[model samples]
Target chain A: MEERTVCEMCDNPPEDEGYELPLCANCRDELSRCPFPLWVKLISGLVLLLVLIAFVNFPSSLRAAAAFERGNKAKSKGNYPTAILEYERALARFPDSTVTMAPLAAACGWDGDLRKFAYYLEKLDGREIRADLADEIEEILLEFEDLSEMEGDEQ
Target chain B: MIIPGRLIALVTFPGVIVHEIAHQLFCRLCGVAVLDVCYFRFESPAGYVEHEPPRRISQHVLIGIGPFIVNSLLGAFIALPSAVAVLQFEAGTVLDYILVWLGVSIAMHAFPSVADAKSIWQAIWSEGTPTLTRLMVTPVVGLIYLGALGSFLWLDLAYGVVLAVGFPYLLVSLLT
Candidate 1:
């Protein structure tokens, strides 16, 4: 009996027409002159996409964290404008963060932009606020009232 | 032909649904507008995702083989915990058996259909196909053909068993 060699891919015996790489005739034709090109693209593309997703998300998350730290440092230095810009940039990358929003409201209030301060405060409404932050916001509101009274007297 | 397809679909309804969903998910991911999606029907094709053809060959390929990638991975992931239980010879709970069944069903349908293969072939031969892409897809096409042949001899089932049971066992053993 002749020793029949097997196709490496499917583990089936090679057809009468033997080929290199221990492949059967059908596998050779299928591989060299593929009838189903779309599948090749699909499988390869998906694997690439999976790899890309894993690579992309990690660095972007790190960048967002760095931006948040920069915003906090700017806020601490009493540079309200720079802090606002950093906070806005950070929020744009990672939106709906209460941590960023609270400091943003404080920055707006300190910069004497009551309208923007009120907007950020409204966003914080119904969410948990620390006792010290709430007292600071109350002080800002009292300051706004005093400014409103002075403007009324000037008018 | 209709009868056979319907019979197969009926027997493997979960696989059919997962297969169609995989195609639809890829279509959306590739930014192709989905015209229609029949997740499971009594028709010959069983289920289908009709969408606008993708502009690039890479996109077309991704959309075509999406199910094989998604289903196989999902099946293996879902089966891992249950696979551990089985390896430890724990009492076969209802949920464990269900997970194994679901995993096997999903994995068994990981191979793209012949129609899908034909569509991919046509795309490969179409204008502006890169030589590198052509070279890359040859072996994949052969493997797909092999998968089709394996289906006839219960090799697809064997593959599911390997993914759900064998691979998990190997992993658990390595970890221990």
Candidate 2:
């Protein structure tokens, strides 16, 4: 008697040629285009609902990001108070973030808030930063220091 | 000890569906006609997307890795806030837990199956293939095998946790 291998998927006689996986003609065809089950529709609906919930909560989820964006925008326009406020919000969301710390220090220095500038600069000490960004921060610190020195000399 | 693939599929049915949808979406994006898509079912493979042979190696790559990109990004996006609230700050609600589960499940199924690797292998080795594409695809195929093997060892779940929890913390730090 010739040996026959059954289709592991559908339990029918298998075709000699096709995919490496064992399957009958019908099962192979079904593999290509199986009819959708009602359960699939229900599950899809549930997934959609989950996605919708995520979308709804997107703004809340990215609260820190939004604040950070606003901070950059305010800083670009030279609005120091708003910039500091936004950067502070970003920092609260990410306390250990050196990215926020450097920027916050820069904004405080520019705004002439010496105490906060010193505090943040100290906090940012030895924190790893991108070389290019570190250069920019260094330049800003020097300029602010020069201004503060000039004011003290006049006083 | 061998656990049936179908049981895993049934447990993470949502992820399986998303994985198939991701494959089908990539097929559409690559302009390959999808002949069949089994989103989810009580079977050995759970879900699959069958498509016509792609015209280019890039298309083949996109189709093969589509699930990884889609599932990981989507999972991270959905889990960002919830992960922060629940894990980082420890101030999450019931809804946050649900979102965390949903996101992690999607991320967990990001790995491409061994079948996808086999198809990619054929595409790379076939006549008229560029050497660069062949070289590039070999490691990718290796990764698919690794992911398949790792799935058995719960590597997929670990990836899910990273996407759900670690990704959120990273995003928060990158803000601005």
Candidate of highest lDDT: 2
Q: Which of the numbered candidates is closest to the native, going by highest TM-score?
A: 2
Per-residue lDDT tens digits for candidate 2, residues B26-138, read 87676555667788789768888887677678888899999999999878867765776566434456877788888888899999888888989999998889898899889
C-alpha RMSD for every candidate: 19.5, 10.1
Second chain alone, TM-score for each candidate: 0.87, 0.91
Which pairs of residues clash in candidate 2, taking residues 3 or more apart in a chain or in different chains?
none
Model 2 compared with the native: what TM-score? 0.56
Clashing pairs for model 1 are A37-B120, A37-B121, A38-B120, A42-B61, A42-B62
lDDT of each: 0.68, 0.77
Per-residue lDDT of model 1, residues A1-155, tens digit only: 65657875678886544122455656544543322236546754664454344334333433444555666788789888988887776566456666667778888998998888999999989877667777877888899999999999999
Per-residue lDDT for B1-176 in model 1, tens only?
A: 12354675687676777787788777766655565677778887887877645667777788779989988997786565565443333323466566667678778788887767767777777777898888787666667777877777777767777888865555534432
What fnat does each of the candidate structures reach?
Answer: 0.00, 0.08
